[model samples]
Target: MTQAAYEHNGRSVERAAFYAIACDPRRSIAVEACAGAGKTWMLVSRILRALLEGSLAKDGHGVQAHEILAITFTKKAAGEMRQRLNEWLVEFAQAPPEKLAAELLARGVPPAQIAAQAPALQNLYPQLLASARPVQIRTFHSWFAALLRTAPLAVLQDLGLPANYSLLEDDTEAITAVWARFYATVVDSPSARADFEALVAVHGRFQAHKALGAALNKRVEFVLADAQGVVDASVPPFDAQFPAFAGLAAPEDLLWAQRPLLQEAAGNLGRASAVTFSAAGSALEQALTAHDADAVLAALLTQKGTARKFGEKIVGIATVRAAQELALQVAQAQLQHAAWAHQQRMARLTRVLIAELASLKYERGWVDMNDVERAASVMLSDPVLSGWVQERLDAKVKHLLIDEFQDTSPLQWQALHAWLSGYAGAAGAPSVFIVGDPKQS
Candidate 1:
């Protein structure tokens, strides 16, 4: 074969070998590759083989429709997988014997066994449709919601959720309503109002809203952090003293003390090289006049808070040296101050936002996808409830296939691990097949 043709044939051989391992129904595997590398194809093939093999199931029949749970990252992906699986099953069911045998062989079936598997493959489509419970192909959130729905009534009541709680796929309306409630309540609350003003002053109203929305989207993370006491205790209060630079005073005090030296240096630098130093000089002069420690710190350092360089010769001057020394101290102090202020404001805002959102959700009998995931995870983790939940899931599902597994949240993975832990090395344990592009994650 020519070089190009030889390389192509080699790739085909490699792919065949890979599929042999990946598509084996008995083996659990995780497939990670870049997009368009047939991760989904391998997943679907594995599902098919599991159905055909039938050895994993309690009955002689292969994994039933309801026994296989296939989860995707998105609804669109779930729909696509469901469609492709159905299409292939239909083709297998209707194709001529030779064609059907060829297809089965290509899907990693041994030649001698094609006839035996062909009958089952041909019957799969109708069996799937006629089965009392259809195969589950769902997004992670949807699957979690379904799991939550199966929780006992007492569990639902303990979680402060209605039995028939509606899922909020789009939480825009709820967020807006929560913000309305926040605005209404902030007027009467001094600390909340101060926190709101601080956030608004820094981010403006529109950006502040967007920031809070982003935080809300990651509320699970916030919840986890809060449970660990990281939110309130991690950042010290803004006004609290922080040790730095031989017990240097506050940034504001340092800035006021160094103003005269900074003013002198600015004038000398401006006169020495107008084009090079005029902007820095003007900024320093303005900040000194305004007695603004933040602005002075900004003028004295790079945006990232490194010491501002005004050439070796210029910086060697006594006034400039003194001013630079003070700048270094102020920059260190001010950076800490900024961090502390930000942590405080965000902690306050996020806490309030989470509270208001939960209140609104409770009032409306609505739960977002995060809520479902969290509730399911909690249910799976509870010592009392986990056994019952595991028993129910073990009876229903025999194989678990997760598409875009890398995109699964920590909580979702935790829940999956918790449930799957019970089945480890046990009889008829559900086989797991995970596929994803880590690059995409």
Candidate 2:
């Protein structure tokens, strides 16, 4: 992990890059790693360099193990990092000199230097382990929870909640109960009852449960902004909605009329139809004799015979053109109505759901994981409290390492950024290292 250990006879571009970042103690580093690129190895190498040589050196003057903060997205990652550091330290310390030399030599260290440095490196065994033990490596949520636990008074005061509030680990049961109660309450009200029934009649199901879950899980709080302009719900006239189909085609201009394919079929009433065995010829014989647009359209749209390639062509070119135009018009009208209905329903339910959840939270004096993050973010928004928290964190942490930076949401970033800014601005600012894949996130 020492800077000198990385000076070797041969090095891959990846290894050189790792050493470059890990060896440099003056500047911050941000890495955008692709999948299976050994992100964990790179991160651990950086941590080790900081511990054995850079900031958290074995010398009494280096930063303490507890001072370096490594934040990742999952508890499993945190455990892996801690385990890796511990194992590497133990392996290098106790292993035979030949074994240690093999490890160092494999890393491109000169053969002569590997044996020479092995003994000195062995001395760092106890120090590295002791230093790593107190190092703060945790998932972002776990870190935030720790922060809140450390200074609950300020966060509680800002949230307008008592200090004794508990975090409801599994909020599904509570949310379900609240949903049931809210539905029952709404159903008893005359206007609400009417709207609820109408929603079910129109959509055939209640979507509020799924909708609320989706909304709550988002990183940013949604503001249900009013529609930018007035919604014109009145159905547009057929001509306005579908200009091509709006103009009625005369019976003679119809595809069947011009082509007279049905007339041909009618001439040979018992001829083999397109499907060979189906009675399409007889059906066409009946429709062609009628010579009505309605009958032609009905036969074109609904008759199974019209589905065949030959049958479709026999429907007449003009008739097919007319049918396509009318079909598009119908489909567009239905789609527009469906979209509008969904938006209106979602808008109405979002407001109701937000209000209900707020009431529930207030009455219960409990919050979920999302609430914890949100509350911490809100508390950090105030300049005074943010400054206080910043000063508190600045006094302890010397380096900040973040993993899965892409998945870090805006709210989480806001809180972390505030502290990062404070740390960056301070004298002898700490190194801020971030690793992530934007594509994966």
lDDT top scorer: 1
Query: What is the lDDT of every predicted structure here?
Result: 0.76, 0.59
Encode model 1's per-residue lDDT on 236-337: one tens digit a residue.
643454444334445567666556788997776666554656687788788888877778777767777677777656643667666767788766666777
Give the per-residue Cα lDDT of candidate 1 at 60: 61
Instruction: Give model 2's TM-score versus the native structure.
Output: 0.62
lDDT of 1 at 353: 83
Candidate 1: residue 152 Cα off by (Å): 3.6
RMSD of each: 5.5, 9.3
Report the Cα lDDT for residue 120, model 1: 77
- Per-residue lDDT tens digits for candidate 2, residues 294-337, read 45444434443233233444434444444444433444544554
Q: Report the C-alpha displacement of residue 306, candidate 2, in angstroms.
A: 21
Best by TM-score: 1
Give candidate 1's error at residue 99 in angstroms. Answer: 2.1
Where is model 2 more than 4 Å wrong at Cα?
1-14, 22-25, 54-61, 95-124, 128-133, 150-162, 188-195, 206-208, 223-345, 390-395, 422-428
Task: Kindly report which residue stretches of model 1 are placed more than 4 angstroms away from their true locations once superposed.
Answer: 1-13, 55-62, 126-130, 153-159, 232-323, 421-428
